[model samples]
Target: MTVQKTEWPDSLWRSTAEPLRDFPELQEDIETDLLIIGAGYTGLSTALHAADAIEQIVILDQAQPGWGCSGRNGGQVHGQWKPDLAALQRLYPGSQFDAFIKTLGDAVELVFDLVDQHQIDCQAQRAGSIIAGKGGKAVRYLTEWSKFWAETGADVRLLDKHASTDLIGTSHYDRSMFDRRGGSVQPLAYCQGLARACHERGVTIHGDSRAVRISQNGNSWRVFTAHGSVKCERLVLATNGYTDELWPGLAQTIVPVASMLTATAPLPDAVVSTLLPQRQPVAEYAGVPAYYRVDETNRLVFGWRGTVSGEIGSLNTAHLRSRAVRLFPQIA
Candidate 1:
């Protein structure tokens, strides 16, 4: 028999991120208060919160910590995916919508607080985020969106065509909005920092430990692995998109969508000054949204929702490089 090892991309945060050296195999059976199945942001964040309350919590991951989307995300903490507040109000009526919005705002704050308290040197920046509109229809849509966000008491300022050009130094967009609420960070580094913090707080993190099968005992659950098993009172399935065969029906609900990104060698100071004068992260609304931001080293990193097919793998750098050049011809 042979074991296949998974590989991760060479992200910018790979060097500075906290390293989780291999852990010894689970030789004997173990019982814990909670068994978390995944080592990404959600799993680790849940572990960090539940660590103080429970007596024992075990986090199981097939790969290394932060090996999934948690480490590979665009790092921008934007508002809800559904931009329409009215639809949200109608769907989650009463105080639910308000509570949801408040919770999102709190989530943004919590990310920053964790970075600060744990002293995570993840290049966390709060310069802000921009949503630019490329054409006539897009400009009108952005205008409506600005008005809608304003009604919800969100701090967003609509930039006219001239103003948008002045800000971005590109005449491609007719208008835009600056959302001061959210910003960007080195996502992988942040995840690694959270994992380290959880470990320091006595959370048992098992890496390279894939949950092969799961069974239900009388009242509890047992997770079987290639090396060992974990018997626990409660189980949390935090493996988003990349969920395995251990949990039935859980994987069907989540569509494992793939996204692609590219990072250029640090841009010239002059080009940076013109493109992103304020150094704010910019994202445009398209069928596939175009997201780009300047990192701490002033490198332009861009990504978008990738076309899904059969298998997911590392994105093509040449394709992404061409896209970047298309967006900023001057850079080419």
Candidate 2:
């Protein structure tokens, strides 16, 4: 199905985001120094970064900017490598591993730095992030992880049960890790702001212009869309989970997984003051983990694994509400 027919999901991010000017559809053949497919964070950020150096840059998206995962994610700015640090050290040489780890550590700053430099209006917060561990394995990992980060002179620490309860307003977790570098944002707004920043920098962006095909044109690359085409010296495919078969086997390399998020009605000021007072986003690790945070409007946005069948609210996320209530009886 074409992106024109897909509707925006009913999400809190959508309802809360300020209006963004829409980019026009591609209507004519064009040539550029760089052509990027997908206007999500990757493509937008790439364009913004290259705007000063590269003279001509063009970006195309299937739908409006941030219509994909960039808009609908949990918004938690987790500032660490997903893989185990020890495992990653074993996989790469010392120099490469050091560079990778440094990048991972500075990832959060890269995001906030962009937001600050561009004056993005996204509801960005840099309070911190908490990873609460319930069982023995999770606790041990947090303990070691905290020590590693602290040894690097990072503002990170492991909290006991009492301290965890005091910080998170919940007593369910056995121990928790707090990293001052992590935070959250209005993800959709951030994406749109990035798009606006790139556009203002003379980067051409076309929404509803899905890259249907691509081929080599001599030393350059040519991209075909429904109503237009682009010839560029270089092409970038930044479609993450929504990757299609534009490049034959490219889509097969990615395994698609779904996540669902639900938000509570805005709580009273009294209740909000007691919950996540420092505004740190929180995650709990048991078996199936859950991540949650307080939004700008004082609503609790809770997220977890979603069904593979592509279901939305109702039965698919009823258990999510129950679990959220279980964590904070005040919400009930």
Instruction: Identify the leading candidate in terms of TM-score.
Output: 2
What does candidate 1's lDDT look like per residue over 1-332, in tens digits? 45545567677767546565654445557999899989899999999999879979999888878888888878877653435555677887998877887787778789988999889878888876788877776676677767866787888779987988887767777788877777888999898888888889898988877888999989899998887899999999999878756678876777656677778888898788778777677888665566888887878888866645524454577777877787678777
- RMSD to the hidden true structure, all candidates: 2.6, 2.4
lDDT of every predicted structure (CA atoms) = 0.79, 0.86
TM-score of each: 0.90, 0.94
Which pairs of residues clash in candidate 2, taking residues 3 or more apart in a chain or in different chains? Answer: none
lDDT of 1: 0.79
lDDT of 2 by residue, 191-270 (tens): 99999899889999998888898989689999998888999998889999888789899988886556778899999998
Clashes of 2: 0
Range of the 10 consecutive residues with the lowest summed lDDT in candidate 1: 306-315
Instruction: Write down the RMSD of candidate 2 (Cα, Å).
Output: 2.4
